[model samples]
Target: MSEMRLYDAAGNRLYLNAEERAAFLAAARRQSARDRTLCETLHYTGCRASELLEITPARVDLSGGTVTLRSLKKRKDAKGSPRIVYRAVPVPPEYLDTLNTAHGLREAAKSRKKANAPIWPIGRVRLWQIVKRIMIEAGIPDAPHRSPKGLRHGFGINATVNGIPLHMVQKWMGHAQLSTTAIYADAVGREEQDIAARMWG
Candidate 1:
């Protein structure tokens, strides 16, 4: 017998079609305060769910509307020496309000417990549960390979479709290689083709 691939053999590896994206956002907007913040953070910053859960108040610069993602990827130098690399990603201006709310909630939780802490009080598992619950509530099917990664993919696709340069997307996504960014550019090529068809028609 052959081993099964991690992804479904006959389905899309990613979730969030255009309609589903809209439904997801709308459903997220209807969620409770904390869940709403989590959804907004995931959608706006395109950070991994683990990264979002690791966020600290210090990592978010509300004045600049940016969030720094700590090094999740291992770095290898010319000699194959391993190091850590952090990436700074800009968040949408709208996330400022959501961040402020999340900060306030975290501070309040800390105060109630007499402990100072990070903005997200939950662990990675809890974050996953939160995202899963939100997706299910939004009527999205829970595919094996689909999770908050879909949100990141949606952000990249939308950004590329909107004409953000591949280099910039790479920087925002914290991708070390330009090739990774080009994949997103290629994903948006269909949109470009549709636009061209409209122009010629």
Candidate 2:
């Protein structure tokens, strides 16, 4: 009958700007400490929603300032065997603090116990609902692709624009290929204007 439009029709600009990011985080924070940490984890680590849900308190290493994320994306080695990749993403101590507060556990306790305890303790559908609610509260207009995936893309593009090394971004993002991470380099933002000004001056 008719072609269905299941995705965004306006444009392919999936990355959120700094202001939008901040607004979304602010909205998330108002929801709960758990949500704030969840959104912060997504923003900082660029992990997929599934990976975020897979996070356990034991996976968080506060001393090392990193969280170990198990990649959910399907990957294959040269031998064509499936590979389960894990990445450790550096995060600020404040993000860990929120996590502790949400779970009501200290860092030491988190490390010594709760190996199987999920941090967010929510399913995929619930996580999506939380993200969509936060986006709405932040006044972000509804769109076909305006969801948690957009947050992940925004984190990647934001990192590239801020001059973070592409390889490092790829690792933090749990991307299988550097070429996939390189797409962030094509995102134009304030970084473009600043570079242009330096050249023009």
For residue 39, what is the lDDT in candidate 2? Answer: 83
List the candidate 1 regions with Cα displacement exceeding 4 Å: 1-8, 11-13, 105-116, 190-201
Error of 1 at 45 (Å): 0.8
Q: What TM-score does each of the candidates earn?
A: 0.78, 0.84
Report the Cα lDDT for residue 134, model 2.
87
Error of model 1, residue 102, in angstroms? 3.4
Please write out the lDDT profile of model 1 over residues 30-93, one tens digit for every residue: 8888788888888777787777776666666677778777657667889999976667788776
Per-residue error at 118 for model 2, in Å?
A: 1.1
Q: What is the Cα-based lDDT of residue 96 in candidate 1?
A: 72
Q: Compared with the true structure, what per-residue lDDT tens digits does model 2 show for residues 43-109?
A: 8788889999988877888778899999987888999999989999998888777777777655445
Best by lDDT: 2
Q: Model 2 segments beyond 4 Å from truth?
A: 1-10, 105-113, 189-201
Q: What's every prediction's RMSD, in angstroms? A: 5.1, 5.0
